[model samples]
Target chain A: MEEKDLVILCIKGNRSAQSELVGSFAPRLLSLIKRYQPKSLSPEDILQEVFIEIFRDLKAYNPEKGVLYTWMKTIAIRLILKTRRLDQSWLKDKTVPIEYSDAIPDLDQILNKMNTDDIMKLIIALPDGYREVFNLVAVEGCSHEECASLLQIAVGTSRSTLSRARQMLKEQYAQMKIY
Target chain B: MENNRKDWRDRLDQNESPMDMGMFWNSLESKIPVQNPGKKKRRFLFWLLFLLIGSGFIGTIIIFNKPKGKIAGQTEQQKNAGVTEARESSLSPIETQHAADEIPTSDATAVISQNQSSSAATAAGDSVHKALTKYQSENISSVTKTANTSDKKTGNNSNDTQIEETASSGNASPIKEVVSENKQDQVFGIENQNIEKNAMSTAHELAQNSMAAMEYLPTLSGELYRELNWNMGYVPTFDHAPKLNQEKSGWQYWMDLSYGIGMAQHAFKTSDPLTQSYLGNRSKYESTLESRLAVWENRLIHPSGFYVSSGLRYQTHITRFDWSKEEVKIEWKLADGFVQDAQGNQIAIRDSAWQQYREMREIRQHNTISSLDIPLNVGYIIRKKQFSIEIAAGVTANISQYTSGKQLNFQEQPVKWNATEELTYKKSNTGFGASAMFRASWYPTEYLGVFIQPSFHTDFSNRMNSGAGYEHKIDFVNIQAGVAFLLFREGR
Candidate 1:
């Protein structure tokens, strides 16, 4: 079967195609979801849930409008947010807001020091607002205007918030001397 | 079908997960098991029973009301008989009884009108027939004058007749005198059989004309016949169609209730960092929605289409930051069942210890802003082959307000704080907005038009002053791309 046909079959409850589709997209979606939800969930946990949601919403996909990959990616991003939002036990125990700064990383120190987990830790350690803005604008690469539209804030608010989030991250790196 | 799928695709992108089709389907299948045959059969049975009961009740009502159909036919026959009887009779009962009732009435009116000439009475009688003839002639002008006027043009003729008749009725106060004389004449009533015959013929003709007039009036005229205009099909010619004082362009608008994850960055300074703490200063606000409506003129069928709507958007975010550190005494139970210092990595129980103190916070913010906007657009329309382009700029005068709640939780105890503040995040003014739209109209039939319109607009006044404390300066843009089904057009 063609890829589109296989996708259609998988959406219609075909077992083998579904397995293959999950394996194909899981890694990337896992990473993306992880960037948004580092502390509340593990990448593995989010990846499993993303697959489950993708299956549930398969019948809703339409091939005529756009490519399946872009469609699936958008869904993964949204679901990662919705499910993580439900488990808000972390809200009661928040960290302090990092101060803003501007500096460059030391290439040698950074290469040796920071792993993905440490970066995830720093990201999650940001104040809730800064972290969310960072994920949507910087990590997801949405335009400032689009980010504001999604976040229901003024465009300037979105821009300033994103800038502050990036600044805070730089300050954290400087404090940790990872850069 | 295509539109449905497109909408579904958009919603899916906004709400679904990011998994490949294979894994998604498997996960769904595992999570949502297929229904059993027995349950399906039972469901079918229930629906079938519902349908049977509903149809049976409707059938019973239809049967009960069946008798009214026969009554309708009988009433129509009775009406026809009554009209025929009325037309055949030489005189109405009112005229026959007039002689007996007019004795005293004529004593006053006859004495008064005798000074008026007998020929004047004849002239009055002639004028009444003239009025009745005019009523009949215009009433049936469509049936007879078909070559001269179309249906709608000739339809107005009846209104003109009614107006004239009303004018004449106001001028005929003298005729009641003669009628009163005839009423008092008792046995002398049979003296003018010819006159009576003429009058009866006039009445019969009037009845026929009235019935014919009834058939040509529009259905809306039935109520209006008793109310304003007193004639059928008159008011429709002047229905409420407000003409635009100026030229306009085509426009479109949208209000999206979209929820996604985003961050808020704010700074706060504590007097003493070691003593004061910001648990997880992040605030979780949910149920935020935004709404907008706009109208455009000129290029599309509407010159500009006006629309206003509102919707909600949500996002999931986990934000954490450390607050304050405190040094204090600690007590704990150890698995080793030994008493020792807790800080040295060997103690089962200790009176006090020092450790790195940190607090993490996660906040979800939902922002809902209700906005009311009216945009007046001026645009130009350009048609090229099957495509039409309308470029217009508008001024959307907007009034918006926002309310937000922040919940601070320490150890899972909810501390809620609410604040209602106008989001002065965008510039407030007689906001200048503009729209550029490319519309393609495909007319496969004379009465139907299929159109796809893509439009973009931006408010020029983008400065937002949050009173004295916070001010945000930014530009706002609105983009919409959609298709429409236009029913009937002016041109054939």
Candidate 2:
């Protein structure tokens, strides 16, 4: 009956309604995939694979989380991460950690405390171990113990690395202020 | 520093956050067009329809094919089977039905005693016991009344039975008088002539009309049979084996192979230093032995007339340990002694050298026991169709003390400990004992029936003489639930 209502029913094993659901959301999901990986795979190719995966595991998705577009977006992100991790050559050479955060704050607080332009530069400059722990613990607000377990490091190392990242940030902030 | 770090942490969080979806999806509406929406609604209704139809079909089949005998109204034939053949045979149509409806003791007794004399001669021993028990129980107080009448008048009691000739009067007095007459005849031997005369008449009845006379036959029309049973249960009392009984109901003949997995602890003194040393300086080590059996006929109680099953039972005990030693090793560094080494020359040594070396020798030991038992039992069913309850009891002979398999493993290999040493086994003079089992099954149809049996009995083997090998007695009490088919049921 309704656009959003139609996609929800299609995802719940209503076969005839699925084409409508895919046509509406497939392009946006593909574009989101393009942001994470630009040229390795086509948006159309990734989108098709994502729809197949979604259809196969439709019952597993929790509807209460968000609307159809947001739900499709989350599935695309998980599949992208999975594809990259499983490609041994890419995994070995890339050595990069995915980043995500749960909090949204005022632009003033971010800029005054650790400005976005400077913060991005600092993150790009930090060493692999330091950057990974910094992103997970500081940016993502994960516990130091959780970061250690996920990164396969000692809790003490996680704490010290996070502390060092903050120290470096403060030094940069101080230097920028002087300049 | 803490506030600055918290602020920096909060600033880092803003970069990795997800987009606000409420506004994102709304903005993208014009970019994506709607797809076909009609066909999807039709499919949902189909699934609902299929589930409803499938469940209804299954419910109908179940309703039509309900376990027929599990819940059926007791018919006249089924209820009449257990009405005591002796009572049913003596009473005419009106009397039998009346007595069966109401268990009037006097009328029922008259009907039972009328046919009791003929049945008694051919009945199995247990049937006789059951009849005696039922008679004693049902008419104990009434029998006391007869005791005052002097056990002399045997046939005169028929006058009391004739008081109400009509069967519908619910007259139990006639049945009671008949039983009393038989009792009188037996106690005073006054009517011994009449009983002999009836026996002759039966012989004549057999000659004149064999088939008609055979109509309520007392003797079991089947052959003698044997059975062996194996049973196991936890023995709460130390004085005896646990009670393991079979559930009685219907033709119950089971050939079971049972094993008793038991653990027993014993404390005994040992001079072996290995066990003594490891036993925390204790003089004796309390060791436990586990027992097991290979094969045993747990139950072989054959109801009279057609079954035979015998098998061997091998039993043993096994023990397990984490750390054990056969001998203890101790290194003693003794003080120098005034003794010659190789050559007989006096040597100057410290005063402590004269101290003698001392070591305690110990050896670890374990014990295991095993036995082989073979029992042969035989029985026969009495009063075929006339008796609803098939009562059987018999004796079994311990045919073989040694079975085919290895008896027990003590250390590593099986040892014939009992065989190696000369044993004066207290051989029993043919072990004799009895068991009683009652089976009653009501078959409403040719293929199915409801069988119920609540039975209990015990077995007795001669007291063995290892001194420790006392009599092996096993008792069984069980209730079995199963469906049986009459391969060939004899019908009149």
Candidate 3:
């Protein structure tokens, strides 16, 4: 079925539509949570929380305004920012500048391999600020200005944080490669 | 990194997180009750309605069924008036006046009567009057005023009843015993002398009074107890206690079997001109068959033939809407050449009914509603020796209602209609309704009375639609026949 129709069915409390929604979106939502609030709750609890919010906010959900996945992703990101804002450490860019290196393989290249679980572990091992900035810029495609506004920081700080996040990820990738 | 954003998004979209789907669903299912929050509120409302109706019915029965017999604080006066009126009817005014001057005559005369014959019963009845003259001022005055025509018979039965009442009561007045004690020693020979004087005076006054008023008393007093007995039973109507002649005042229960025809009024409120043109008529009656089952209906009657009644009636009403109206059939269907997804699931849905047809139809539809009705009535009875006619008007409440059958569900979302689509009717709150009933009852036996009551009853209600309401009323006239189980308390 069409995603919009599935959303409508979920809004109508259709169990199949609800399960399909959870099944289809769990991996993306879990990846987002790993960048935001990985250690706070289990992966299962985080998905439950996100899906519950999605179903409840279905009434105010306007399918004509945006795609369902974009809307759901926006909601999950907002919820993460709300929890992460309580710890100002996540907003602090403590990492230093680094030079570009060759150890960082393209994530798309690794996904084409048999398994790419080590790349997710490398991202999770990064500091909160770098991971948040990296998720927004490298994964979510938000502009530097939007990332700064969302994380309550300056555009230059957002840009510098993204640079530091990529260099730190490259170091972690090199270490994983050596191991 | 901007170019890598697409690869990262694509990889994340392709990846599937491992989860306990069963546990996650169970957790959500636990919150299903909280999702639909109105169920709890509706249950509370149902219980509250039940409690209110139940308490109201119980309160009606308690208020209307008052205990009967005996006027409080007026017992002493009744006894005095009863004895004095009986006494004055038997003797001449001069003789009653002479006997009453003696405060201790009744005991001696009662002794004399017990030892002698029925002639002595007449003389003892004079003593009964003489003993009462000091207490009953109005009756004594009425007796004295009517003395010129005092040719009524002796009060032997009244004396007997007075003795019976005095003997039965543990709290009888000391004055009766005090009078008896004063003449306790004079019970025999001299009492006979007083008896002779009373008997002679009785005959002389009977002649003089019969010549003036009651001609029948000459023969009655001429023989006393042998000719005249139980005549004091009628003396309660002597204007001293006219309340004694009042009608039977108690509660009665009647079971009514009613058949009624209800004229239906569909006062639809809609901006849809098509619906307004179709359903806004009050043209004819919806053929109705209503069977009314009245239970615990206790009727409280007053001496003036006015009564108040309250009860519960479980009435099943079958109403038919018989008329022909033109209706169009509509269905929602996908247009031709609509695309399907890779999964072969239909990717598009029809937004509105595009496929339609027109048809002429006759709607001879019927619906039944069983309601628990609490009806209150005030009526007057014109009672006869064998039968009675009652006229009553009151308001009624439909406390609990259950409805069945299908009608035109104009309240449906999107106003969709198919040729065979029929929706269940929702029960509505009908406030108080005005009703008038005329009943005629014939009591062939003492404990059972058969009655036929014809009534015009109207029920006012708002037919609910999508949380708004429109006026819909039903007016019916019915005839009911039933047998009433009569429960008459004392003082009838």
Candidate 4:
């Protein structure tokens, strides 16, 4: 059945339709959760929570604004961020200048050489503040202002943090190439 | 680097992981709880129907069981009877007089029946002739004189002799007619007097019945044993006094406005060590200004000394707290950042050379909290002749609260000293409080009284926010003296 029909049936309290909807969206949502999940929480646990909230609030869904996958992914990302308590205080300890380095490798070369798991591991190894900004701005395609509001920080801080995260990723790739 | 960033995004999109749907479905299916929306809606509708039916049944009972007095029924019957009697009395006057004259007499055997009827009819005609004579004497006396002259014209003929014989017969007829008319007039007058006497007797009986019914009527003061006797002068006694009677059992209202000074003690409880240390040894009782206006209703259940008093009271309390002057040292450690020096110049902080600052200053803090509370209470009063003692306990709802103060905080460089901050506790900060008071009042006049009340009040619920890091409850004891004016009473 189509996604719209599945949503209507889900709203009507159809168990099979609800299960189908969950099954169809689970992969993309789990991947998003894996990117933002803190060390303390399991990906499966976060996915379970995300699906519970999605079903609970399904009745309030308006289809005119966006597609189902986009809406569901937004819910997953917000829940993961809230569970980690990623406020502006996360940026307090780490302060670095956004200067370009000669030793940094080209991002295109690194992306071409790296597999999906290697890239995911590199993004995960970033600092809590850098990883959040990089994932939201660089990977999730949110604007710097949007990332600032989501993380409750200034727009300037969000720009500087994204710059610092890119530099750190280039330095990590240089070290991997040396190894 | 910008070109590399654009290429990295494209590469990131190209790497999508294939998902195992069966495994994910099995896990999610186990976690999702089954929902029965129809059953939930039906249950809600059932309760709503039940509530509506219950309220309707209660309304029906109340409407049907209400008191319906007999006063309306008695007045309606009297009105109908009066209307009938008035209609009968309003007939034409001539018809009623003729009816009176035609009443048959029992002496018909002594005289010819036809002669008796003719004589009664002639008597009525003679009365009409006498009325016409009196009316003609006023308006046309000359006409009578002319009739006498005409009699003289016919004097010497047989017609004159015939007139003389007829006149003589009419002379006897006039006397007999006068006697018969007098008897009929006497009978009509007796009937009129009998109708008036019957009406007066009915009126008298109605008045007696009304007075008897009043003896059984319910009194406004709920005095069931008292009887109203019309035969005796009804002086209002204390036992059967009206509800508004100040000397008896009824609702009495008074408005009292009072202002006084009180002392309050603060008790703090907290799990946070920093908040606990911040409020250390601050257990001293502080003075507060208290003002209250209350309208009280005292219902005296009987002529005896017991009464129940309840009312709405509005009170405002102003409490001041002064954290005494103390000297303290402040310290700050800054990492790689820009800091302002005493000369207001920015200096960069490096990892090798960490920036540190210290300052010492004396701090004095003052806080004031104003609160408005509305309390409702019920209590019993013990009264002697002109004095009463009352003990009341009730809950007060704290409706509004405001707290303003000057405190110290640490910003980037130097500690901000004595910052004026308006701190508002949450709406949950004001909760229901309990109070108990003892009042001794003396009534110098029927409408005025003086009283002194000592009251103890404390919040039964946590009136302060737990998220403020420390929980604090305040209690106060106040002794207030004020004059009360009796605004109204249930009965006059």
Ranking by TM-score: 4, 3, 2, 1
- What 10-residue stretch in candidate 1 chain B is worst by lDDT? B160-169
Score candidate 3 by DockQ. 0.06
Tens digits of per-residue lDDT for model 1, B341-449? 3321122332222221112222233333333455555544443333334344455555542333233222222333233222223233334434333343443432233
Candidate 2: stretches off by over 4 Å: A1-56, A65-129, A148-154, A168-179, B1-177, B180-492
Reference-based TM-score of each model: 0.29, 0.30, 0.33, 0.38
Deviation of model 4 at B200, angstroms: 20
lDDT (C-alpha) at residue B124 in model 1: 30
Q: How close is candidate 4 to the true structure, as a TM-score?
A: 0.38
Q: Which residues of candidate 3, in runs, are more than 4 Å off?
A: A1-179, B1-248, B253-274, B280-290, B323-360, B406-424, B465-471, B487-491
DockQ-wise, the better of 1 and 2 is 1
DockQ for all candidate structures vs. native: 0.04, 0.03, 0.06, 0.10
Q: Write the per-residue lDDT of candidate 2 for residues B1-492, one digit (tens) a residue.
A: 446556755544333323343344344332222221211223233334334434543464455446334213222222232223434443222122322322324322221122334222222222323333344455433321111222223233533322211111122211112222133212111112133233333433333332332221211110001000000101123223211222332233332322222222222233322222223222212223344433333233323344433445344444321112212222333332233334323243433212111112222333343444453444333322222333334444434332122222123212212212222333333344343334444444443434443333233553332332123332333233333343322211
CA lDDT, every model vs. true structure: 0.37, 0.36, 0.50, 0.50
lDDT of 4 by residue, B363-382 (tens): 33344555666666666565
lDDT, candidate 3, equals 0.50
lDDT for position A42 in model 4: 46
Give the alpha carbon lDDT tens digit for every residue of B1-492 in model 3. Answer: 534545655665455556566777778654421132211122243334335534543454444443222222232233223222334455533233423433234333322222343344333343333333322333433333222223222223422312111111123221111112222243212123233443344533432332221212221221122212211111111333212223667665554544543333333454322233233232223453554545456677777788888887777666655433443444564332223455322233323334332323334456675767788999877654556677787888878566566554222233433334454555776576777766677777656667776566676664453332233455555556777665443436
Chain A vs native chain A, TM-score per candidate: 0.69, 0.47, 0.81, 0.87
Name the docking class for model 2.
incorrect
